[model samples]
Target: MGDGPDLIGRRLREVRAWRGLSLRATAELAGLSASYLSRIERGERPVERRSTVEALAGALRVAPTELTGRPVAPHTPGESEGHAAVEDLRGALRDIELDAVTPESTGGLRTLPELRHDVDRAAAASFACDYRCLGAVLPDLLPRVWAHAGRIDGARTLLIECLFHAFYLAKDLGYRDVGWSIAGHLHRAAEATDDPAWVAIADYMRAEAMVGAHARTRALEAVVRSADALTPDAGPAGQAYGMLRLSAALQSAATGAVDVVPDYLAEAADISRHTGDGNFGGQHFGPRNVAVWRVAMAVEVGEIDRVPELAEAVDVEALPLGRRAWFLMDVGRGLAAQRGRETVAVDTLRQAEELAPQLVHANPFVRETVADLLRRARRDAGGRELRGIAYRMGMGA
Candidate 1:
């Protein structure tokens, strides 16, 4: 949906800023000229090839999907059919069985190596926000992954891992039903594997998806039950566990249980001391991630002043573009909510729009936030850009 060249340019700029990188520094790191980088950020240059996108993502410490979005062809049967496809996909998952899945499911040789290759690529696609490709591929991918649902092989374990990312794609797309399906599959896979860390991840994602439903109590129960799933010495698995704990804290903040939020935050902070910053549960979880969550938590509690304070303590640039962009959205929102900060807030939102246009545009909360800004904004100056975004989201009536 983000077809304009400017969308990509804005992402380049927003992510660069999040990482605390200057235009000159990022250009040097990506082996491009400052002028070109600036142009790309300004939407003047056409986007690059996958290799170039990958290079830029690497230099910026983000997944390719953050920059490229879904690599949809002109005729790709997505966007228009996304809602229906989700329902159809759910039906497929509902009917799957270990006995039913086999070599034929893959349309060719379904060897472990080949299947894993596809699984990895699918995970990458989810990170890249290639929803159309992911939606197109999942009908096949799910069955193959489900084939080993109860097995304890590496593939079986990876099934949980793959499902983890799959759930992410679903959640980001606002298909919570699909996310719950992914979560159910992961729960079964984690139970099958009997792996502590994987189990922690399953519990974590469950809590994550549940928060969207405003089932704070259910989400709280989930993380609490997984409390002993891993220790700090468990490496990424432990970090994953701690990350879930942090998620629970965010959930508490959402419920306005400010008193309980700090306990969960403290526990997660302890876990982060061991793992620092890491790619756990396909999400960034570390001390800095904890700090980032604090900003979001502050926004959740309507403590706008605290949001910027917490934000400055964490350098978002170290996060992947997807995560970095998400964090910035909160910052932008917090700024927008404060008196006399509407102008800065609009600029912040613009940065967020550039980083992940669909994520910003498709989210109802963000739309409402922008709508509120519009109601309060003046007619001239920055209002023009805000109005343009409102029109795209079909909001500024």
Candidate 2:
């Protein structure tokens, strides 16, 4: 959070200069005003939204990570170990991709119940935001699940779940390539089950994995199509359908389809009313979660003023630690974008970190926000707090 050379604004400036485009030219390309872009380049404003980052990256002809600084260097020993696990997972997934996941390859054939138990543990670790534990479990579990997926009932479903864990672990750690690979495996596994519900879930996960890839429109279309393919009713299918709608809402917001966001949100809200609070396939879909997604979409489009009211409608305590932490992170992001709200933003982010330190620390947006806050903080108690949060994020004081 100190005067880091790789801040988004600085990166943007560097890219623009290298592209030989004037500030106004780049602004027009990104659909932004010159003054706004100028302020951003000067570090007077923070790039707080993914949509903005995507737009700028598109204009600059660079990957979104080029600006967001993703796949960030590990800051602690635990983080380093978590990163190291990615390679092991990659190898396991590669074995599956190559059709090499035999009994011998997996070390031994495992019972369905045993594999299910391992998948459940991985899911639990994911919900708890225990990245180290999640990372440790998946590299060994995935190939084993694949070995049993052919002859055993429910083995494919378990395989899908393990792939879900792998996808999130890779994605959360900023390994988008690994996430995309896992998503492909997930889709194939879900299709093997011949269940439309599982297919829809995989589609949603694929769309999520597409985030920051500068494919916002395609991601939105995929999510909406999958959501529409499902019949809205009570139970797990309904819950999965509702999550798709929520994801669609977020995608719509990210792509600047402002009018469509409400429709998606409203549909998801109605679906949630029927599903109630349920964790179907690890997605905590309910009224509270729908409300949380509303806050997130609002934040995406820079509707900071509406975040508090939308957040008030959500009971975040009812969510898993991961979801709860994300909601708090979104609230912190919204607060950070508003003038005179630095102290509250730091406090909210601290709350998120308290709930899930690994998740909070690993988020590129949170780190960027903390850095921006530190740059603008007054030299007082608030500055000290900002520095503390920044330090925890591994942004340095």
Best candidate per lDDT, number? 2
TM-score of model number 2: 0.96
Model 1 stretches astray by more than 4 angstroms: 1-78, 81-85, 97-99, 148-152, 211-214
Q: After TM-score superposition, what is the CA distance of residue 207 in candidate 1 from its true location, in Å? A: 1.4
lDDT value for model 1 = 0.68
Report lDDT (CA) for all predictions. Answer: 0.68, 0.84
Q: Please, what is the TM-score per model?
A: 0.75, 0.96
What TM-score quantifies how close candidate 1 is to the native fold? 0.75
Alpha carbon RMSD to native, model 1: 15.4
lDDT of 1 by residue, 1-397 (tens): 4443244565677788889999999888776788988876765553422234545776898754455443221222344344444565766676674355664564644557776888888776666555666666666677676665444247786677677766776677667667877888788778777667777878888877663223666787778778665664548677877877887786676554678888888888887887777776687788878888887777776678887778889787777777777788888888877878888888888887776665666554455467666667688788887887776655533
- Candidate 2 lDDT, 26-133, residue by residue in tens: 999999999999988887777888888888888889888878777877787878878888989888877777888887777787788888788989988887878888
